[model samples]
Target chain A: MSVSANDNAAKVSVRGVLAKYSVLIAFAAIVIFFAIASPTFLTPANLFNVLVNNVVMLAIVALGLTIVISSGGIDLSVGVSVDMASMIFVMLLAVGYSGVVGVAGGLGAALIVGILNAIMITRLNISPFLATLGVLFIGQSTQQLATSGGQPIYLTSGYAADQFNAIARTALFGMPTPVIVLIVLVVAVHVLLHRSVFGRYVQAMGAQPGVAWYSGIRVPRELSMVHVLCALLAGVTGILLSATVKSYVPLSGNAFLLDAIGATFIGTTLSRERKPSVIGTLLGVLLLAIVKNGLLLVGWNFYWQQVGIGVLVFLVLAASFGLRRVAH
Target chain B: MSASVLHTEVAVSDEKQAAAKSAGRRFGALVVRLGAIAAFAAIMAYFVIFAPGFTSTFNLINVVEQSAILGVLAYGMTSVIIGGGSDVTEGGIDLSIAANMGLCAAVYATLLSMGYGDFLSVLAAIAVGMAVGALNALAVVGLGILPLLATLAVLNVAAGMELTLTQNTVVGASSPLLGVLVSGSFLGISALAWALIVFSAIMIVVVHRTSFGLRLYAVGGHPEAARAAGISVPFYVSFTYVLSGFCAAVASILTVSRLSASTPGSGELLLSVLAAALLGTVFSRRFVPTMGGTLLSVLFIGLLANGFQLLNVSSYWVNGVQGALILLVVAITSFARGSEGSR
Candidate 1:
């Protein structure tokens, strides 16, 4: 009888551990599978390429989304902010503006979207999901109007272009500039979300708004500030994206929207209370980026890669939640 | 005696103030309830005066016909939103509906291109939609995933499957049945418009008159109460998704019939569908989504698009205008309700 009881306890502990760390385990397993399946996957060059090219922009966007999700709101217009920034940045440079001016314009455009979202959510009493969705639609139309039926704006070989590209291309401390930017933003967000008073208030509000309100957290003002901060982070990504590609492709920023949402949600599995965290979001971005790159290297078609990613997301969440159910 | 008289005077004034406040609220509610219809009428007036060719019967019929597919899709979304109940984060949306429509169309076209019988292909396409819906239901109801994320996963998977099956190319279908669906008119109305009418009729009966719909509304409006009353909340919620899937399948058939081809990225109608369904809420004083409201909202959007084209006012402005209109309508609706509207 005692032996059986001991065995049951061991099983319970195993399930508990699995439930808590399923995302990390699945991520590791995917990495190992890719490394074994593709000879080029383990190389430093390929890994660096993944970090700099595929991961940084998505990481920045997901990090921003992480803030909104942490604040108990969803920002479907992250793509709108991203597109606005890139569009304004490219347009400014095309019109003989300097790189600094273009970057400021880009960030400013993104900030407008955030401000609009804040107003709708806080003042007008619109739900975050609906407000952001409305912004997304309006943003798309605005882009189309500006570009005359959604045409791409190419910035090929100019002083401003070269200067803009340097934001992404320049290396700092043996790391690419964008990657360095991503790391700094991640650390700042981590400190903001995890180690600061404001972060605590945000989390408290998210966890229980009624409680936070009674406790005097100044819910509406803080929520507005959170959205603005989130938009700024997405703007940084937009600038980086335009710099890397050297063009502003209308509606291209929307491609990151779904993936960023997926990554942030996947990252939530890493938290004990299932809150969004910066480190967790970064890891989630890394996992998705690696899978995307590995699948390409492994000769999977684009459609199949999407299927693979969807299945992987479902499985990771299922594993974590399902095991938690069993453990309870 | 003087003190008592002073207190009585204060109470009488408070009662009068309360009565006046309630009367004002009643007037606000009336305005909010009429907001959507008034906007529709106003926009129609503007187009009739400003846009040439907008008042033609042919153009009006064309707008209604164009609204058919979106109408059907919006009705399905309305049911899901209603089932989702009061919480925005709950199971109120099916983001994969557009993707499901694309995949179903692809399936139908691919099967016909492979020399399959028309009836068989249609059935197979519908089956695929049902399967996708079942998968979504299993993930959301059975496994307890957030409705948004679960539908999003299904969207990616469905879209990818569609792209894979079509090899990222358009697939054409040619058949007599499809021809009738696209061009055959009865009583001066297109068959597509007829389909919308039939679907709307069915939705009205199912959602407003049937026990199933009552249970669904119950589940959405108050899950705890519904559960206490012995309603299977999960079953009803799952059924909404399945119904949405079925609607998408029906819309796909019409889409293929009209275009004569299944193209990649037909899922771009997602935002429009969402907008129509969301806009439906403004028609109700309580801000509840209804099939009637959704059908009207779809027509409103269709008319706007048609008028914009006639006026040559840059078709790009339609989406922005639609977004702005939804915000304004919902804002007014919520504002009229005061503190209760904040949710």
Candidate 2:
């Protein structure tokens, strides 16, 4: 009996390790497969482009999502925040405003959305999911309305074009500006989430709101702050995205919503307790960025590439949870 | 002893508290029904008073015709919400249903254009829809992923498949059968509207008059209790998704027939479908989803949009107005519940 008990314990531990590290393993496998299959995949310039061009905005959005999920809520409106910012920023530039003022206008728009989300969720007792869904619908229509039926705004010629391009294009220490911004934001969010008092309270509230409230944690305030912080990150992403494209596509920010959610959930698998973390989200973003870049180089159609990413997300999640359930 | 006397007093107070709680719950239900009725009346009055041509019989028929597809989608949403377990709002949301409909429409249109008969195309479309339902069940019931996330992942897959099938272009089903089904009217109503009414009636009977329906409500109200009563909880949970897929399949067929074409934009109706279903809850006394209520809400939204268009409001603002109205209704409903609980 003692020997059997020891064997069962060992088996459970093995399953736990597999559940935790499966995504990492899959990430490495994908990288190797792409490197072998495509001649350009392993090139330094291509890889750098993937890091600089593909992952920066996604990484920022996922970082925000990581915090929101850690606080036991979701912000489906994050994409709208990005979209609204882009709309305002581009409209300002079209009217001949300076880039700095345009960016401030964009961030201000995102801030209002964040506050409205907090009011709905905390004050009105709405579920975060439904609240954000409402915001998403409203946001989409607002952009369409502002653009007079959803036309994209281009910065054809002005200081707006030069200054915006420089924001994303200029490199420091041999790295693109967006990559540098991503690194700085990642470190700041990592430290804030892992070491700050507010972060601890957010985690506690997520684990058990009733218990956290009884322990004197200000649950509502922390939850609202998390949403505000998330919106700010999305705002930054909007600014960078418009800068990179030199255009504002109405409702374009919606493309990132599902990917951000996917990356954050994938991040959850990295923790034994399934908590969200900055490093895990970074890894998730890298995996997605690489898959996208690699698939494009391999001549896959745009739609089929989406299909592949969806399958990847589903398989990783199923494998992890299925194995854990069997072991238990 | 003094302790026994004190225990008796405590029991008496508990009985009083329970009585008060039930009373508050009844009041809450009353509030929801009344609020919904008032809101519906207000919308009608606004349209009749402010918007010209809105009161005409022709426009009324047009509104109902426009709402037919939404009515079917809402019926599916209602069934899923009622049959799922606790956390109904989150657990019952099937984001892939609209995308599933798009894929079905794509498949049906493709088959029709390839010289296949109508019967084969319809069967193929439904089969594909059910196949997606099976996947959703595997992810949600079998693997225990959150319903919202699982359906969302499937949504992407379905949309991708649709894009690949259509080559990112609009395709039409231009056969005689589809044309007749869309254009032929019976008893002064179009075939599409008739289809919606029949589907809604069938769903109402299935959801309210069957043993399966009772079992579903039991599971959704409390999963452990249902399990203890020997019901297969996972089976019922997964069955709702299957039913939802069938509804989408049927809706897609009608939609493709009506429009004579299917495009990537077909998936954009998801938010409106969800809103209609949620708004339906306000018409219920217990805040539960019902097919009759869903049909009414769909009509309400369709008419509202028509009125706005007559008033020269941009069609883009329709979505915002719908969303804002839903938020207001939900707020009132939840506030009533909160007050009841506090009482």
Candidate 3:
């Protein structure tokens, strides 16, 4: 009888461990699989390329998404913020504005979207999803109007262009500028979300808005501030993206929206409470970046790479959630 | 006797106050329900007065024909929205609908190119859509993933599949059925418009006049209560998704027929479809999604786009106008509903 009891305890412990770390295990397994399949996958230079060239902008965007999602709101117009900022920034540079001025214009455009979102959600009492979606549509049309029917603005030459390019291309202490920027953002968001009293209030609101209100948390104010911060982060990514490409293509920022949402939600699985977290989101971005890079190295075409990513996302979430169900 | 008289007088005054409050609430509800229709009427009036060719038979028919495919898609979305509840965070949306339509179009074209009969190809394409819906159901219901994330992943998969099959090129097909679907007309209306009407009628019966419809709504409104009532909540939810997939297939057929080709990247219709379905909510007395409301909303959007084009307005302005109009209508309705803004 004792032997059987001991065996049952061992089985329970094994299941608990699996449930707790399924996502991490899946990520590791994929890494090892890629390392075996492609010899260049584990190279330091390739890793650096993945971190700097492939995912810096995505990391920044997903981190911002993590913040809004943790505060019980969704920002479907994050792409709008990115596109607006990139549009304004490039337009300024093409018109002979200095890089600093261009950056300010870009951030201001992004902040406008955030402020609009806040007003619609708080003052007008619109749901976060609908309000942001409306903003996204309006922002798209605004871009089209500004560019006279969706023309791409290229900044190939000039002093402002050089300054803009330096944001992504230049390196300090053997690290790319964009990578350093991403690191700084990750740390800042982590501290803001996990180490501050405001963070606690935001989380409380997210867990239960009614309860948070009853506890004297200013839900509306914090919610507005959260959206503003989220948009600013996306604006930073927009600037980086413009620097990397040396151009602002209309609606290009939408390419990152779905992926960032996917990564942030995937990051939620990393927490025991299934809440969004900065470090987890960073890791999620890394996983996606690695998968994309590895698929390219393995000779899969772009379309197939998308299929791979979709399947991977579903599988990871399923395994983690399924295991947790069993554990309970 | 004097004390009893005084008590009766107080009771009469209290009853009068209660009646006044109820009357005010009813007025507020009526205003909220009629807001979208009022906007629709106002916009139609403006277009008729200002836009050239706004009342021409050709443009009017054109608008209805163009709205047909979207109308069908919106009907499916309405069912899903009703089945999943009115909450945005709930699993009531299918982001993969447009992508599924694109993929089904690709499948139909590929099958035709491979020398399959048109009827057989159409059936196979629809089956693929149903399969996609089932996959979404498995992920969302069985695996317990959030509906938003699950559908988003499926959207990627469907789009990727479409791109892979078509190889980023348009796949054209020719058949008598396809030609008729595009150019054929009946009773001074296009065949596509007829399809829209037929589907709407069918959906009205299925969603409003049937027990299945009631159960689906019950499942969405309160899953726990539904389960307690032995309504098979999972089955209803899964069926709604499958129904949405089927609608996408039908829309795909119309799309492929109209263009005579299945184009890559046809998933861009997602936003317009979502807008139409959400706009439909304002037409409902209880602010829930309804079939009639979806059809009307689809026509309204079509009319707006048509009028803007006729007025020599830049196409870019249409999107902004649509967004602003939706925000305004939704805001009025939400305000009229008082503090229940989260819905």
Candidate 4:
């Protein structure tokens, strides 16, 4: 009986160790697979492009979603904020407005959306899922009305294109502007979430609203702040996207919602306590970005690329959570 | 004698106040139920009065047929939500139903184009759907993945498969079988509509009459209690997804037959399906998903869309209007439901 008990304990410990590092191992394995499969996979130029171009926007949006999810709220309207920012930015530029004014206008519109989201959740007491869903619907429709049935707005003139593109194109210290923006936001959010009283309060409310309320956390106010922060970050993404494309395409921002959600959840696997973290979210973004870039180079069709990512996400999550269950 | 009379008067006043409050509560509940139906009726009446050609028999028939697809989905969604209860668990909701339908339709179309027989194609499509459902069950019930995330992952995977199959191009069946099946009518009703009616009947009986049906509420209401009573919690939860799978398969088949073509965009039906399902709850006393309520909600949306089209409303505003309608209904329901809880 003593021997069997020792064996059981050892088995449990092994399971726990495996669950903890499964996602990290999977990430490393995928990277190795790409390095071996493609000669250019590890090249500095390609890697830089992945960081500066492909992954930056998604990473920023995913980071915002991480905050909301960490606070136990889901914002389906994040994409809408992004789209709204894009719409407002492009429209202002089309009217020959200065770039700074355009940026301010876009951000202001996004802030309005954020504030509205807070009201719906805090004052109305709607569940985050339903409330954001309602916001998503309203936002999508509002864009439709503004754009007159989903027409694309282009900055065709040289001045407009150049002026708008500067936001995305300008480099500081040998890095793209968006990449720099990403770094700044990451640091800010990390500090806000991990090293501050507000962050603790947000997590507390999310962990248990009733308990937090009783403990004097002012649950509604903290929760509302999380949504606002998320929306503002999403706004940043929208502006960057507009700068990249030089156009505002209706519903173009919707893709970020799913990808951000996927990344955030994958990031959770990296958390020691299964909480969302900035580093974990960045790793999640890197994982997705690598898969996307690697698969394209490996000659997979775009549609099949999504399949690869989906299957990979499921496998990684399944392996991690499945082992944790066994350990418990 | 005067002191006794004064005591009796005070007691009578207190009783009267309590009776008044009870009546007010009942009145409020009645208003909630009637309010939704009234709104729906009011909209329909407005359309009939203002839109000159709206009440034509031909238009009405078109509306019913068009609504058949949503009705079928609403039926499945209602069942899933009912089984999930108030707190949807790891496998509570099926976000992949639309994607599942798309994939099934793509597979059916591909097989038919390859000269496969109708029976084989139909069976294969349903098998694929059921297999997807089983995968969802495995993820949520067996593996403990959250229902929302699991189904969402499945959705992406299914969509990817569909895009791969069609190569991002629309796939059509050259066979005349689908055309006939779709276009063929029964006693002035389309076969698709007939199929919907049959499916609804089967669902009503299954949900309301079967032991499996009765166990769903018990499991949803309190899983621990149900388990203590010897109920297999996973079985009922997983079964609802299976039923949903069957429904998606049927919806796919109907769409394939009607369009004679399948596209990746067919997966876009998820939102409308969910909206209609949620709207159904507002018509119920307990705000639970019910079959009759779902059917009515489907009709209401159908009417709204038809009216919009007749009025020459810009298609751009359609989605916004739809979303607004859902938000409004959901808000009202939540308000009523909240009061119910407080009382």
* lDDT of candidate 1 at residue A183, scale 0 to 100: 84
lDDT of 3 by residue, A122-187 (tens): 778787887888888898899999989899988878876697767867888888888888888889
In model 2, residue pairs whose N, Cα or C atoms come closer than 3 Å (at least 3 residues apart or on different chains), thus clashing, are none
Query: Model 1 Cα displacement at A246 (Å)?
Result: 0.4
Per-residue lDDT tens digits for candidate 4, residues B208-302, read: 78887778877766789989999998898888788788888888888887787877687779878887887787777777777878888887888
lDDT (tens digit, per residue) of candidate 2 on B1-343: 8999999999899888878777877887687779878988998898899999999987988888788888887777777777664263246778788989999999999999999998999999989988888888888889877677688788888888999999989897788768877778888888877887788779888877889888888877788999999999999989988888888888888888878988777777787888888788788777777777788889989998999999998999988888788778888888877776565
For model 3, the superposed segments whose C-alpha errors exceed 4 Å read A1-13, B1-22, B339-343
Q: Which regions in candidate 1 have their CA more than 4 angstroms from the true location?
A: A1-13, B1-26, B341-343
The true-versus-predicted C-alpha distance at residue B25 of model 2, in Å, is 4.5
Each model's DockQ?
0.68, 0.62, 0.70, 0.56
Worst 10 residues of 3 chain B by lDDT: B334-343
Model 1: per-residue Cα lDDT over A59-157, one tens digit each: 999998999999899898999999999999999999998889999999999999999999998898788877888889899999999999899998878
Clashing pairs in 1: none
lDDT of each: 0.88, 0.84, 0.87, 0.83
Give one digit per residue, the lDDT tens place, for model 3 in B148-197. 88888899889989988989999998777788888898998888888888
For candidate 3, the per-residue lDDT at B273 reads 87
Models sorted by DockQ, best on top: 3, 1, 2, 4
